[model samples]
Target: MSKTNLPNESIETYLIRRRALMRLGAMAGLGAALPGLRAQAQAKPATPLQFVGWQYNPQIVAQNVETFEQLYDENVNYQLIPGEYAPITETMLVAGKKFDMMYSEEATLARWITAGWAQDVDSMPDVAAIKASMVPVGVRNLSLPNGKLGGLPYYAGYGSFIYNEKHLDQAKLQPPTSWAEFLEQARQLKKDKIVEFPYVSAWAHQAPSFSWSLFSIWYSEGAKVFDANFDPVFDDKFTSVLEMHRTLYRERLVSPDIFTLPQEGVPSYATGQHTFAVIHDYDQKVLNDPKLSQCAGQVRNAIMPGATRSTFSWVSMYLMGAGAADPDRAWNLLRFFGGKAKDGQYHVIKRWALQFGLGTPYTEVMNDPEVAASFKSWKDTDVALQQLQNSTPRDVGKTLWYQDWDWYMMGAVQDYIRGSQPTSALVADLHKQVGVFKARYAT
Candidate 1:
């Protein structure tokens, strides 16, 4: 069989054609189900498909599963793996467990593909449509080096500046348009006593939050931690990035409690204690919830400030296991989660985005009027799309040793933030550690 080619269209043209296709498919009684997938579903009785992923929301997952079962007549045994997702997934795959469908991130997917554990998603019948439906970041992450599709892009979380608009108003300040402007505003907020701490860091001593905070600054400044050869390339640009954070710590503009805060700086921003924060897309949703946040309706999302507006991009993907008992049924189920249904809706990813504030990579869903209307902040979706456009793929794509590299870097950053290590010493140590990791892990 030949490989499927996805349509490449501008945002406007894509939306127009997508809408037309939906109408045409519905009128012809075809529904939005992929052609070959719909036929396969009707030919067989429902069978149980084991699905695993990190926890999203229990109720939301249950609702989606229930809907999927009713629509396709398939039973889904969905499990939310506990503890760190990457390590847990690695253990399961290494142990040779059978999972028909698995939820994964781009980094984890890269490792799994290299280990020969992931099935090429391009073999699925709907590959063309799926590719065309997603944004560039999704396409780049899910497609492997040989041009084979590795996974179905589910949802993406991009970094952005989420701030308390009410606090900024009180201080007679606007959201900063550039990195220099951001520094100026931080100083102004402190001078005017707008908030005790104008900025908060989610620099927790762990995989996700630590890396998320570090990369938000690193990428926004247009710096790369690793070169094409996967060698650690520490330069003045990297030094400048670290020094920017050091300055914030020295000036007391950032919360000192960040060192011990396991919740990733949400408390500071949600309580209106800090006027500004760098946070993921979902963090924006959390801060907008009136029941969960003191700032609730007053929160707004802005593009990250820097010489070039760039931020870290994360993807949650759906992969077919290499050892699947039923590849056909597995493909059907995977399509159910990532593809549009008979009603022209992406039930799972759409609900996930609405319940949480994370962005879906599906172009149609992202631009849907109803979905846009559901966000508390009018600009949230727009800012998210903009960030995704300018995003750098999660660093794992650049190197398989991302987990090790991140561990060493996070430790050094923690020490530097706490004044246990100076900037010069931290830079030197980073170079040394990267060299060590490369020697150990590089093939």
Candidate 2:
């Protein structure tokens, strides 16, 4: 098989250029050396396939791999890598470490495809049919500029507006129908001492979640972060959004540590430290899990509070390494995990949906009766599905430079939150920064 190239590059020439770049270590390392990887550059059928991912649901991952190995008479050595998944994965690839398959965010996958670290799946068996089976967003997320599928969808979900029913009830309030109402209710919650801070979000700058939270709010107000040409257009309505956040912070209506909390503050929300959040919809499962949450039964989802009632969505995927020694087997594993196994069912994807409340891009899985029943246990299915339907992936995130820009923008947002600059100045600086990135990446 030939290596894939950018749409404008010749395959032979691209390979020569990439080889020189790799030898020169032109890509900066983002992690310390990964330990315990096999030194061999290639693998045979007997060798266990190497798999790696950031820590999440390890038991389920292990069980799924075990089932696959048992059913196929194969072997896989799966390892959980800690910290900074995308950058570390890139560093490993640049250092010539081989992994058969790994988890990747959509923007991270795009960057990897452009950097020659990921193998496009255009040549996979039944690739056309597989692509057709996915939702439009899934197809868009995985499709490359060269018109090839980047990978198979691991999971896709949108940010959901979640509120604590107990908190609302205690404050004698209903779920807010609009952003203004939400602020008022939050004020009441704080005044009545039902919660010290009535809202929290995933804003930690170390991750791209700050943008995730911003997009949810911006989209709810009928704004897109980028236009059709992928230029920044968020400023049209973003001033008010920033002001709302400013009010929340200044009045202590949101968590004091909002900027530092990890991904949605699952523990904070579950333990009743906060009453509302705009994090991934799938977290409703973990938040409502009795074993994992103190406020399990009281958490619920509502349409995001804004005129448009829209939110941000994104997809993460399972990508094959460009240097996979056994392409055929790697494709098989990818299909098994991402689509259907030999059992003719979407075994792994369905398991993630039913067990962990993860979303699926496949129509069949989305409509599966079992999955629907499972969700009903933890969320209002109607509201959950409505929010999902109303969400759109942030268009700006499709760019190759998005990850870099996301980190830069997170710092800018944090500065604004800290009252270091006025909203007008912050917007001006953001626009200027966007121009700088546009010029640098020439996107």
Candidate 3:
């Protein structure tokens, strides 16, 4: 039969023929070369695709899975792998298992894609559809080469200043408008004893949450951690910004407990212990739980203060992984989680990942007059989006690996606040540490 006149072939048949032809060509080169080539072209059992993520919440999972199953062809199956953030990713990369989908971050994605693991699904029709559904900034940060929306943002919220407004009134202070104003308010509250402790954001104990705080502060000052080549900048704060943090601490205007405080310390500020806090906008959950926090009505979520600039971040930007068994499946997950599918069922995982959390990305869903009206304390998702949109990406300098850096930095800040370290000493130590970090992670 003429090649042009070949009979209609099923999709499966086409893949088979293509594989066979590829094998024949490889065999014509070398017998050994053909073995690896054959494996690449081979198909594995069509089982349910697996996704391991830290952002998993049961309700969100149900929402996403239901939509996926509905839209998924009979060939695909959905499986969720339960794991926390950093540990889960580290485990996956180290073990080399066959996870069909990996929630990717843009920084790490560059490394993974460079390793030839990412499957190119740019041709998929849904790719375009998904991008169409997202807001502009989401499209920019989460997309391929920083353009194509590769992974659906299962859910996202922006970093901002979440403060205790009740204490502000007690301190006879107005809400802050700038970084200077923020510090002024905190100082007044501390002096008036409206709060026994200074503003304590025990950021490091909560790594992602710490990133939120750092990114917010850095962006507020027009600092960026990533250059074109992913340079991590540890010392790029706007004039004396780091010094200011140290000054606030050394002056005993901020909390000393933040140095070794438990993970829940900073967040618990909404409970009325501390007068002010800086955190992501989506985490107003502290204010809603009337049982946990005393500052329920007193808690306010608003824009991050700006010095040279204002900024924000999601827990993460979903990027494509480096090595995936089924690149297409991985892309499918990205598309779905990133909010590409039109079906309402698609947000199940997004909802589940956030089943019991805050700062969702579905602007429409989170902003539904009903959703906002239902939860009086539900912080506005718009605040985060607007903050991020108004500002630039944070200052990581040469790398995105700040897990250790934040822990150390926040500790340093706490010590200074407790009068354990002098501001000058803290700055000097941090400057040295910044250099060490740049050497260890940036280059």
Candidate 4:
């Protein structure tokens, strides 16, 4: 297999640095770039700032990079890592690669900071303004374990409950306000033959959306998976949640193929094959788009159902690499992408929101009339934003071993669903596993 195919490869097998796999740009002399670091107006060397990110929208990224280059006269050598972005980037870093800025996910941020690959931005001059610009959850997600701001948001959003209004209306049912109600509604739809599977989910093991859906349900039911001490505390509420899944699967209310599906089962809802989904807020844009979804005009958003009506939120970021040779230049680039640019406007972040339906951390961007108007094209602005307020970041993400634990948890969940383990056994095993990881990563 190609080195880029590492996502499916075992983590232990690829931990070693493979120089042949890296495609980084040439490194520049720190002394030569020091002047440019002090101020954008200062004389600079010919070397470009090295910036790297995973493939998402390379054309948009290139356009934004070109705009940054034009606006600041800063040279940037931008590169895209093809697969398993964090592991590849970490391998590159371990191999002594240097870059000014890189994309980071919340699950990997703690590990990056712990390994000294990322620099905390709390000491930056614009830190206060940047913090003020973002939502509370964004700030929390971007912060290091030490409470220092680790980076700025590339995008921040929450998992939300989305439903097909057409199906509900056809069944003469209202949108659900609680898990009990939700299950009843699903049954009604299924019984009426509105759809074979009235509910759909992206619960495939090892899929990122699985974690999002798992936590969103846990939170909606007021279950804290972990305590402040980083211990697993989800045992009490986990049985009900797990049972809910079992009931759905056994009764044929949810698709039997959901275990293998990817990403919120968008096509199931879009094509009107399913009535309900719990997906990230941005996906609503796709789910409701006229060109993309057959249920375009029928899809609508609702805050997740439960007593608290809560869900899990998260952020991906633009982190300043500790290995950045030109700290100020790197900060400028990070700010340009994650915060406001020299023009005092959030050009890139705003574009990510308005153009792509991605969420933003900036209060101004979130409240922008244009942004709200844009959301109205695909989703309810109030429900979407309200869901943001009701969302909370996963505390376990602060651990260096979070990704490892998350992977194990996903497999365990799958086992539980398959009846390979009982609820008590599953919860006990999960807690024991958390303790093992905690002990292994202890200071």
Candidate 5:
């Protein structure tokens, strides 16, 4: 709900003018205090920069802001937008509102850039240095279709199977290597009373998460939704992907609460009740936190299992607003958050990765020997980074009509899970809808 200002006058302009007038009045009222006051007034003013992004750790945000203000003497007004950041940002941009910087994920970057809402950070002088410091996957994910950089990398996450090591050890099962193996493991765990519901699927009808869950299976089977020519290609492999989830549901291996769970699979896993979950790399941070997770320190990560070890990979980036009032200051703020500070210390992202086990796209941070030494499980982090090399070729939301496609896809998934439609019928409907979306929105 927090916004910068109305179209007539921005909050920054009004504050600057008001402060200047007040300073003049104070100087006029007390001439004797002018010498000390003059020195303070002459000091570089704090440039007010507005930033909007998904909700982050408040303590982390405060620490980053303090460090940035100390380094550059600028005030960053960070607003954490909760739930569905892309649509909220798109709406704000359509209304002609301006922000200094905003957060966008890889799936939405193409749409945001094409709509002229994002600035080309690649044009900045420091970009070459920054790019060199980042992981190659992060840089490639943030690149726009025209070969310009759409944003600066914040963090990168790859989908992986997170399991409780204790449960797996008790069941005498190694992590599953293929979809068939995964189902069998879950069934055996349930049969042996190792865990009541061994698998948790993120089936909440939402953009990105819902699509991401399906994509994990599709990608594992070496399937792609769209061809290079932008045509919808829903073959039998995709049908099998949907059927895989149906099989889990039919076997009662998946949680019934999946339909209504607001968040992703992390919550179910954290309860210490589930044996396996498909989750983002960042979820490891929460699962490892003693205060948040009952199974803390017992969770382990593996590359998602299938015919091939493939999973979804994504990056969230700090996108400079195209309509920024001060482009240099905006870029500086973005650089501070995304890269190192004036003291040559990495700022926000580094601390987050170290303290919470969140994945980082900075090679320096990941490669730091100290970082690997600090974790209870270094192999988990190492495996996730290694799997980043096998990420899906394209995010599903790259198309402009992604919202339309998402609606149809999510509904079909729900129908299949609830037994309202069979896998063959659902696949047929999905293919037909993709054709409709392609005709309407594909270029």
Candidate 6:
């Protein structure tokens, strides 16, 4: 028997036949749509990469982690860690433990690379991209003493003489061109009662694993701790640098407690207690925090008065890490963090992140019309750019070379000068303490 004959017999059968054909057409339409849906389903998740760093704020890391995770493939999990910068350094020092990304200052980088804690970064395919992304002063200096790119570039800030700009303007004085001019200006500012105190520079704690900021001022003074062959030559310039601090201290520009300020007198400076301060180019943004500073934008940056160098500067340098299981994927994360991409996501993320005070590192991003225009609202963008172009590298070994001798020296400087404690006495005290590290571990 033919089943078709039976199906056509009923009153409802005629309607069913028409409905079946319509269902077939719908099936065909779905088939047409299936290819794109299949492609979407089959697409690979972005490879998982780990980025570990010292997020200065916990809340920031939490918010950005969600965004970063969403930006990558759903299968890719991104974790952001917030902690001290030094721990990240120590983590990198651990052999064979992979960190997809990390950051450090130039001096710490020198030590890590010197001690074989860091891998050769030239092996990365994104070296060219890093070069393109980073500023000249920030990354190119990596090849100086070590002959390897130690770290990727991050934000580079100027080491300027910070001051109450109103005071300088009121006194009809321009920013000084040299230390002599700095002292002379200090005296004038003091005499004019424009500043309650002369000038003091107090850096944050064992910061950046070193005192490269002070090195910047010393380099500006045309001083070096080592000769061309890298022999230790701590002599006249070292004493001169020491004496300059003493001169400022003696002049009462620096408070008695300035030598050991934990907040580096940011609290005092923000309160308008000082006429001048020596601080990083970024200090303006930091000190201007509404909760911390009353003076706010009144404090501004000027070129650090030095001997010869344009501006000896220290800055944070970030690098793509070795031992990443996915080097290419890791580079993508770095590129994203470095802020070089033209994509809207990058622009939005960087602008937002910078609001938390971590400045963008890339030229394309920093100079992006949108980002640049916004930055100009705060300061003379052109002048800041010009100053950035005018940076000098800190020596990695010897004098201004790697790590925290200057910080140790800065700490000891107070007792040595004020209490009539000799340099030999300070050195003797340090000899029993830090000298062992210098000799045992000095690279």
Residues 298-392 of candidate 5: C-alpha lDDT, one tens digit per residue: 88888888766888777778889887888888888888887776678877877767765666678888788867665435346567766787777
- Give the Cα RMSD of candidate 6: 19.6
Per-residue C-alpha lDDT of model 4 across residues 1-443, encoded as one tens digit per residue? 00112221322122111111232333222112222233432334577788887757654676787788778888776766755677777898888887788888887787887888887889988798779878887898888878899888899878889888988988988889999999998888888888888887768775356788889999988888887877778666757888888888878887777786533465556666788988877877866766566677888998899878999888989888886777888899999998899898898988988877889878899788998789888898888878888887886787887778888988888878867567888888887888787778878
Better of 3 and 6 by lDDT: 6
Question: How high is each candidate's TM-score?
Answer: 0.84, 0.85, 0.71, 0.89, 0.84, 0.74
Off by over 4 Å in 2: 1-44, 145-147
Evaluated at residue 352, the lDDT of candidate 4 is: 86
Instruction: Output the worst ten-in-a-row residue range by lDDT, candidate 6.
Output: 1-10
lDDT of 1: 0.70
Error of 4 at 390 (Å): 1.1
Candidate 1 clash pair list: none
Tens-digit per-residue lDDT, 1-443, candidate 1: 10011111222232233212223223223112222333444433565677776644433555676677778777666655544556876787788766788877766776787787777788778788878888877787777656688887677776778888898888778888776788788889888888777888677777667788878777888878777556666777777878777787788888666666535666556667777788766766666666566677888888888867798887778889787778887887787786677567788778766666557778788777777887635356666667779998754453566667688788888778667576778888887887787678667
Ranking by lDDT: 4, 2, 5, 1, 6, 3
For residues 199-251, what per-residue lDDT tens digits would candidate 3 score against the true structure? 66644544554555666677777766445554444453632566666666666
Q: How many residue pairs clash in all the candidates, one count each?
A: 0, 0, 36, 0, 0, 7
Instruction: Report the poorest 10 consecutive residues by lDDT, candidate 4.
Output: 11-20
Q: What are the Cα lDDT values of the candidates?
A: 0.70, 0.75, 0.52, 0.77, 0.71, 0.55
Candidate No. with top TM-score: 4
Residue clash pairs of candidate 5: none
Residue 284 of candidate 3: its Cα lDDT? 60
Q: Give the alpha carbon lDDT tens digit for every residue of 44-162 in model 2.
A: 34587777765555446767776777677667777655545667767888888787888888677777777777788888889998988888867776666556888898888888999
RMSD of each: 11.7, 10.9, 15.3, 7.4, 10.4, 19.6
Error of 4 at 293 (Å): 0.9
lDDT of 6 by residue, 109-153 (tens): 655555454455666665776666667776656543645665655
